[model samples]
Target: MIGLVLAAGAGRRLRPYTDTLPKALVPVDPAGEGTTTVLDLTLGNFAEVGLKDAAIVVGYRSEAVVERQAALEKKYGVKLHLVHNDKAEEWNNAYSLWCARDVIAEGVILANGDTVHPVSVERSLLDARGNGQQIILALDTVKTLADEEMKVVADPAKGVRRITKLMDPAAASGEYIGVTLIEPTAAAPLADALKATYERDPQLYYEDGYQELVDRGFQVDTAAIGTVSWVEIDNHDDLNRAREIACQY
Candidate 1:
C-alpha cells in the first residue's frame, strides 16, 4: 500500500506561520539536526513502515511543497507525488480527499498531515492487516476524551459504529489519530462515498466520509494504539505540544 497524506487544509488558526504556508508545512520540531515540519514526520513514518511512495494532497500554499519536494524525497527516501486540490481553501477535507480518487485504487495508508505521532501508530495499522478488514483506523483509546477530539464509537463484535467531532465526550470510545489503511478492494467504494460526502456538504471533514461509509453498510474497523504521544497541530498551543512529544520519537 502507498502512503497518502491529506495536507490541503489552510489552518487559519496558525496565523503568521500559515500566512504563506499550509498547516503541514508549519515547523513543529527540531529532529535529525534540522527543523522538521509535521509533513516530515508523517513521511518519515511512512518510510519506516516500508511504504516507499506517498501522495500528498496540496493546496492553499502548493508552491511551498513544490519547491521542497525534491529535498523531502531525498530526506525520507520516499518518492513524493503532489496531489493538488483546487478547492482546498474553499472546501474541507472531504472534497480534498475526493481530489485523490485516482490514487485510491493503489490501496493507501492515509495520514492527516497535521498530526505528529510516532511510527508505531502506522505499524499498528499495518500489523492489523488482512482478516478481511477493509478500512482500518489508528485509534488512541488511552487518551482523555475532549470535545475537540475526533471521537468514535464502536462495536467490538462488528466494527466502528460512528465517527464525528461533535459527539459527547462521555459517549466516545476513543479518538481517531487520523491514520487509516484503506484496502484495495475498498478504494472505489470509499471514493464514491467521499464524493457523496462532499456533495452533501462541502464543509464536511474526511471523517464524515467514513461515517458515510458506515451509514452505507461498510465496516470501518479500528486498531488501538495503546498509549502514544500525538497531537494535531491547529494552533500555537498544539504546536508547542507537538514539539514536546515529537522529539520522543
Candidate 2:
C-alpha cells in the first residue's frame, strides 16, 4: 500500500506563509532542531507504519515541494511520488483526490496535508486492516463536536452512514480526522464517487465523496484515536496548536 497526502488546497486563511509556500510546507516547528513541515510529520507517520512509498498531490506553489522532494524522502525513508492537480486552486479537495486516481489502485493510507497527528493514529488504521472493511477512517469520537468539524454518523451494523459538515452537531458520532485507509477494492468506486462530487460542485470537500459512497451502500468504518492530540492547520490558531502537538511527537 502507498501513503497518499492531498496537499493541493491554497489555504487562503493563512496569508504570507502560504503566499510563497503551500500549507503543507508551512513550518509547524520553528524552534526545534530544524524546520519541520506538516508533510514531514505525515510522511514520518507513514514510514513508522511500514509504508515505504507515498504519493503527494500538489498544487498552489508546487515548487516548494519539488525543492524538498529528495530531503523529505531521505528524512522519512520513503519514496515520494508527486501528482499534480491542475485545478487545485480552482476547486476543493474532492477534485484533488480524484487527480490521484492512478495511485489509488495500489491501496492507500490517505491523509490530508494540513493535519498534524501522531504515528499512533496511522498505526491504528494499519492495525485495523484485514477486517473486511474497504474504507477505514481515523475518527476522533472523544473530541467534542463542533460545527466546522466533518461529522460522521455511523451505524453499528452499516458502518459510516453519513459524513458531512452540514449535519447537526448533536447527531454526529465523531469527527473524521482526514486519515483514511482505502483498500484496492474500494479505490475505483471511490474515485468514481469523487468525480461525481466535483462534477456537481467544485467547492465540495472530499468528505462529500465518502458520503456519496455511503449513499451507494459502501461501508466506511472507523478506527477511533481516543483522546489523541492532533490539529488541522487551517488558520493561525490551528497552526499554533499544531506546533504544540507536533512537539510531543
Candidate 3:
C-alpha cells in the first residue's frame, strides 16, 4: 500500500511558521536535528512500515514542499508523489483527500499531515487490515472524549455506526486519530463519498465523508490504537505535547 497524507491546510492558528509553510511543516520535535516538520516523521514512519511510495496532498505554501521534495525523498528513502489541491486555501480536507482519489486505488495508509504519531500506529493498521474490511480508521479508544475530537459510535459487529465531531462526546466509542487504511475495493465508493461530501459543504471535513459512507450503509471499520502517545497539532498546546513525545518515536 502507498502512504497518503493530507497536508494542505494553512493552519491559521500556527501563524509565522504556517505563514510560510503548511500545517504539516510545523516543527514538533524540539530535539530533532534539522527536522522542521511532522511530515518528516510521517515519511520516516511510512518507510519504517515498508511503504516506499507515498503521496502528499499539498496546498497553501505548497512551494515549500516542492523545494524540499528531493531532500525529503533522500532522507526517508521513500518516493514522494505530490497531489496538488487548488482549493486548499478556500476549503477543508474533504477536498484535499478527494484531490488524491487517483492514488486511492493503490491501497493506502492515510494519515492526517498535522498529526504526530509513531510508526507503530501504521504497523497496527497494517496488522489489523483484511477480514474483508474495506476501510479501517485508527481509533483512539483510550483517550478521553472532548467536544473538539472527531468522535465515533462503533459496533463490534456492525462497524462504525457514526463518525463526526458534532456528536455528543459521551456517546462516542472513541476518537478517530486521523489514520486510515483504505483498500482498493473501498476506493471507488470512498472517492464518490468524498466528492459528495465536499460538494455538499466546502467547509466539511473528510470524516464527514466517512459519515456519508455510514449513511450509505457502508461498513466502515475501526482499529483501536491502544494508549499510544500521539497528538493532532491544532494549536500551541498540542504542538507542545507533540514535542514531548515525537523524540521518542
Name the runs in model 2 displaced over 4 angstroms: 30-34
Q: What would the per-residue lDDT of candidate 1 be over residues 40-127, giving only the tens digit for each residue?
A: 9999999998999999999989898999999999999999999999999899999998898878789999999899999999999998
TM-score pick, better of 1 and 3 = 3
Candidates in order: C-alpha RMSD to true structure: 1.5, 1.2, 1.1
What does candidate 1 score on TM? 0.97
Pairs clashing within candidate 1: none
Candidate 2 overall Cα lDDT vs. reference? 0.91
Residue 80, model 3, lDDT: 95
After superposition, candidate 3 runs with Cα above 4 Å error: 31-36
Report the CA-based lDDT of candidate 1 relative to the real structure: 0.90
**Per-residue lDDT for 1-249 in model 3, tens only?**
899999899998888778888989888768634375899989999999888999999999999999999999999999999999999999989988999998999999999999999888898899987599999999999999989999999999989999888889999999999999999999999999999999999999999999999899999999999989999999888888888988787
TM-score of each candidate? 0.97, 0.97, 0.98
Rate residue 82 of model 3 by lDDT. 96
